[model samples]
Target: MLPYKNEGEIRRLEGLADQNKLTNEQRTELTKLRNERKAHEIQVAALFDKDTAKLHSELEKIDLKASKPMTVSTTEPI
Candidate 1:
């Protein structure tokens, strides 16, 4: 939920992660922060978009991997 709101803590945690030293709870929190940050960025980018689906497709293609895929969706009525 933090989503880099605590910049110092995020950096410290990331340093630990790079050293493979995160506790289970720290790892979970870091994962959540990264996800929330990514979602926030995507939403901001979508605000000026003319084609939401095209944006989603482009992002998916940019970050998607054979072993891991990311999904972005909206339920607003068109």
Candidate 2:
């Protein structure tokens, strides 16, 4: 899916493509938009992957803390 910021551009391109005729400039701009969208997708995917790894690391730490035994101390009054 196109990013929110590019939704308008995607709509415009869809309208242009639906017309079945494009000016040279329109075609060039369409190609540029497609490349930009592809680059955005790759960047977003990388960010998501990084975030997932970070979350997994955090979860592992939580699990380790939960598995460790806790200690309690009791003392008698002198």
Candidate 3:
């Protein structure tokens, strides 16, 4: 997922750069949006890490289950 809140902050900053009038509440809103985006990014990365670990664990179990025992053959002397 993209960081929409961050994008909004960028837009707001651009407006500020253009000298657009902004209320105090709008400034606070922009700060809140940026913080929320950061938090969301952290959450998404953590979830990805968890999922990757789970997949690796599952693959290891599959490898363990799919392994075969070694066999030896004996021949009589002719």
Deviation from truth (RMSD, Å), model 2: 6.4
Residue 46 deviation, candidate 2, in Å?
0.2
State which candidate has the highest lDDT: 2
lDDT of each: 0.73, 0.79, 0.74
lDDT of 3 by residue, 1-78 (tens): 545546856686768847967668777777777787788888988988999999999999878765755334223344
Task: Give the runs in model 1 whose Cα sits over 4 Å from its true position.
Answer: 1-4, 50-78
For residue 4, what is the lDDT in candidate 2?
47
List runs of model 3 lying over 4 Å from the truth. 1-20, 69-78
Clash pairs detected, candidate 2: none
State in Å the error of residue 51, model 3: 0.6
- Report lDDT (Cα) of residue 21, candidate 3: 71
TM-score per candidate, chains pooled: 0.50, 0.77, 0.60
Candidate 2 lDDT score at position 30? 84
Worst 10 residues of 1 by lDDT: 66-75
Q: Which residue segments of model 2 deviate by more than 4 Å?
A: 1-4, 70-78
Candidate 1 colliding pairs: none
- TM-score leader: 2
Overlapping backbone residue pairs in candidate 3 total 0
